[model samples]
Target: MSLASHLDELSRKHSDIERQINAAMLHPSIDALEIANLKRRKLALKDEIEKLKSQPTSH
Candidate 1:
């Protein structure tokens, strides 16, 4: 996939995970570990997006 498309997919995933985290926060029964795992995954996605954005894709 092109860099732009890859970034878009990562961003979409990040947003989805963000929504999931928010929704999980609203439920009293949600496990803290699950929420933490989601947060870690979200962070990883963000890092990947940032890394992709920073590099010169054409190089």
Candidate 2:
């Protein structure tokens, strides 16, 4: 796949993960550990997206 395609896929996945984390956080029965893990995963995805955005596009 091309770089743009890869970035699009990553962005979609990041959005899905963000939604999941938000849902989990809103659940009253969610365990603290689970919430923490979800948050960590969200942060990692955000970092990856930022790294991809910072990369120079190939002509």
Best by TM-score: 1
Q: What TM-score fits each model? A: 0.94, 0.78
In model 2, which residue pairs have backbone atoms overlapping below 3 Å?
Answer: none
Model 1 misplacement above 4 A: none
Regions more than 4 Å wrong, model 2: none
Worst 10 residues of 2 by lDDT: 37-46
In angstroms, the error of model 1 at 39 is 0.3
Residue 50 in model 1: shift from native, Å? 0.6
* TM-score, predicted candidate 1 vs. hidden true structure: 0.94
